[model samples]
Target: MNSLTIALDVMGGDKGPHITINAAILAINKEPRLHLFLCGDKSIITKYLLEHHIREHPQLTIIPTTETVAMDEKPSSALRNKRDSSMRKALDLVEQGKAQACVSAGNTGALFAMAYCVLKTLPGVERPALISALPTHKENKNVFMLDLGANVFCEANILYQFGLMGSVIAEQVDGITKPRVALLNMGEEDIKGSDHIKLAATKLSANKYINYVGFIEGNDIFTNKTDVIVCDGFVGNVALKTCEGVAQLVYRKLDRFLSEHFFARIIGKMLAPALKKLFKSMNPDQYNGASLIGLRGIVVKSHGNASAKAFEAAIFEAIKEVEQQVPEKITIALEQGLIEETHTE
Candidate 1:
């Protein structure tokens, strides 16, 4: 329980206000000091809140709005057409200093588009990047990788900015001091990746504030070798999806194998306790929130299909970022050591 309020776009998720409202209840229950501004269609959201016996709860506030950004809506249309959307209004709460952060399980492109147009980037940030705290090599540890499809085409300076922003998140949230950062590459040598990555690696290496570990191949992403991996949106998004896909495949195959084979089922029952722990640790729901870092205010994107439990995890992520004041940490880090943009203007 902390003295912070979080804005939630209750209309944006796959299940609409049901999931988001439930998540708001779950989060507020868990954190007694937390307050929520649940922004969306007032009548609908209020109905759900009343059904849940929370319509007049002191900790929750409902901001009335009429429209929502469609999942398939073009970014241009969302930005221009939907001025009063729940997603936009939730962000507006933070921009107007009514809330500390905003969380939405809405259109990705629209969120990115709206957030930038609304909050703008922090000082010295060329652009905001999509970052996620991915569960990595060690238990309870995560790697903050960025530019996760926020900008498909990033310049060398933009990539460098990712390292700085990633560094702040890793240090502030993950508690990793001087987090080991690396440039994703086809090979471990300097003669790898596009010129953008190479140039970014060079700049990061020269910066004393960051612990740049040169280039690491794709496999190294899951290893303990690095805490932050910098790359353009195209590569980061592909790597993120590929890893999630493989994880889902492994879980499915294990379940099928256990069910199909009698011997394995017996063994699985015996190992059920340990296997359960493993499964919980590897659950994608545990990592449901992905921070759209580098913005002036905090904004988290939740998985569209997230359940109440999964969406609760995302709310907690927003809470942690707010409690830690991650955006402020990034600002201080930039002011202390704003690297020169070496790439061509």
Candidate 2:
């Protein structure tokens, strides 16, 4: 049987090792051919293993690390000061080729910093960006949004590159061949936003390599008008978080309205199954992870508040990314100059 071992950081996150350990166990049970290298305090992991009665799985192994990178701590400090931190150790396993991928629900900034420092970026790529899949109304259709929180400030050329890379990922993962790419702007016209938007649109439209769809407003996101949406990290991150907040508000409102009265409660009971299925399809946790694109290896960033189910989904995402050799494909795209660098001639 082909074996794929993943390095999971157990000591990073708000819940410490609880959610991390449980997620690992859940992933192992879901995929028998999968093995996990748990990096954290050995004693803590061992205790959880014993408590959960998961002591004797040949597929599971634990690697001890003395320190941990905190959520608020800077990545540089964590890397330089905490040599034995679980997050750093996990990346080390990936660097050594001992693991196929690494998953951490821990510090986001630290993970990005560590990944760039260790794995490095592919040739022709400026900086790595975070790409996430957001569900849309169209059946089996999802939009790929990038620079979710990687680089807060990006140049026009960087946004153009993000379009190319985001398009590649959308085609590969979402099966959207000939994906339509768009720049996130306040207006759809050619003349919109600041000098940056105009510059990016001009450059993107001139690129024969990308199917640039001009500009798309934020409201157009749910219309499935475009397959890939590219923007700076600041705007992308705000949009992503706004969507999440809206989803939560809707869920809460629905729950309160449904349980408030006897008639509504009866109606809710009748529609519970269908409503649950619909909500599950739209839940952020169901799509709780983002891929750190442009890196040399496959690295996924899961939600900080991810549950076992969400973490399990992240593992499956990692498996698929590795199986498809996404990094190699990206390298090929970069080498062929499919992504161009803009110059002010």
Off by over 4 Å in 1: 270-286, 339-345
Best by lDDT: 1
Candidate 1 lDDT, 71-146, residue by residue in tens: 8899989999999999999999999999999999998889999999999999989889988866676877777788
Tens-digit lDDT track for model 2 on 1-345?
A: 538988988887677788888888888887888998999999999999998897767888899999989989987887678778898888888888999899888888899899888888887688899888777888767888889988888888788778878878887887778789999999988777888878888777777667889899999987899999999989988898888777778878988999998999999898889776666555443356788888888888878877777777787888888887888877775554444433322
lDDT agreement with native, every candidate: 0.85, 0.83
Error of 1 at 4 (Å): 1.1
| lDDT score for residue 100 of model 1 | 94
TM-score between candidate 2 and the true structure: 0.93
lDDT of 2: 0.83
Residue ranges of candidate 2 with Cα displaced over 4 Å: 273-286, 338-345
